[model samples]
Target: MTGALFEVTFYLAAPFWALMIVAPRWRWTTRVIGSPWIALPPLLVYLTLAPGDFAELWTVVSRPDLEALRAFLSSADGAAMIWAHLIAFDLFIGRWMYLDARRRGVPHLALAPVLVLTILLSPIGLLAYLLVRAVTPEARRLHDREREDQPAQ
Candidate 1:
């Protein structure tokens, strides 16, 4: 049952990823991503796994030691809990990236691959997106607002 729920957690998260990656331009995608509750399903998975062995989890987390964490996450339940945790956080990060990109007026074509890379490996994906953001200007209104603040230079 624990293992099954582990798989179900990712399945639940997949659609949000799809919405952000595939149908990113849709009005509904933006509306749907606006809700933080998109994280609820994986949080439920965490709730299920945590109640059963919270003491061990507490130790592993509080110590912040590599060996302790490795030992705890070695178990099926611990692994599932951590997986759920990752799924929830990754989705949240992805959602933020999506909304921020849209608000910044970053092009969809440029962001799609970055979102895919995030799903595969988040650190690299984030680095890539940061590079994109550094080079790409935000919405023109932002630049205009900045100009208003500057005394004629």
Candidate 2:
């Protein structure tokens, strides 16, 4: 893809991911935004940093004679573009997870070690937090009382 097209794609995708973070009213957005699979676009772009590979992929869709597309993808600028997208998307997802944890009343002390672990090893920290949240008596009680307190409407 040409540099301009790559930039446009990044611009479009970044805002969609950002909306996942900032738009709290839309809960489903969280799932879409937080899924690490969103990393694919930038990863694909990163793979395209080698022009020959980019051309090969493009050839699957259209004419192979688009040498400009190949050159653009091969450039260092393309790699930088991919890097920026990956970093922004990852940070947004991380921030969203942190905020969600805090909103759930995960205590700062309990959350500290998890946060550290998440930074160093994401899956383990996430699983640990899920297990802890699941079994936490206080969390259970709070949820139970909240449900009990709900007014019939």
Candidate 3:
């Protein structure tokens, strides 16, 4: 169980870091990346609830010699770290999405609240954004045109 949990955390972190690097250059990559902010909570919950053995595994892998890092690995600090990471990641994803929407000509004023909601309550925020995007006739037309322009396999 410890190993499994550690793997899960790594799994959640890996693609996020990768996308952090890749998404800047590739607009299409953003679609595949989903939203790391929204995706991290369940993994954090799993980490918080899993047994102590998971901490031992994580510490061994991380090999954090600093006092702060060690403290963070401890059960009490671990929860704080999880919450911090979640908020930070969510904010980053929300900002990125907001900027992306703006670059795509989606109005900033309309997108700002949705981005804020996503940062505060990820899944629902994402659902609201999706629903709005889907229902907007112009957005739907653009999406359909993009689909039609796809090259044949």
Hey, what RMSD does candidate 3 come out at? 12.0
- In candidate 2, which residue pairs get closer than 3 Å at backbone N, Cα or C atoms, i.e. clash? none
- Candidate 3's displacement at residue 40, Å, is 16
- Candidate 2 lDDT over residue span 1-153, tens digit each: 546545754554555444433453367665665565665665555555545444544553376455755554465564455454454454444545555555566565665566455544556767876766666666666667878999988
Q: Write the per-residue lDDT of candidate 1 for residues 72-107, one digit (tens) a residue.
A: 889999999999998888888888889878877888
Q: Write candidate 3's Cα lDDT for 1-153 as tens digits.
A: 444444455355445444434353466545645554545544564546444445654774478566745655675536444554565566556646654564455554556567657756877777777776776666677778889999988
Identify the superior model by TM-score, candidate 1 or candidate 2.
1
RMSD of each: 3.1, 10.8, 12.0
Predicted structure with the largest lDDT when compared to the true one: 1
Quote each prediction's TM-score. 0.89, 0.38, 0.49
Identify the runs in model 1 with alpha carbons over 4 angstroms from their true place: 139-153
Better of 2 and 3 by lDDT: 3
Q: How accurate is candidate 3 locally (lDDT)?
A: 0.57
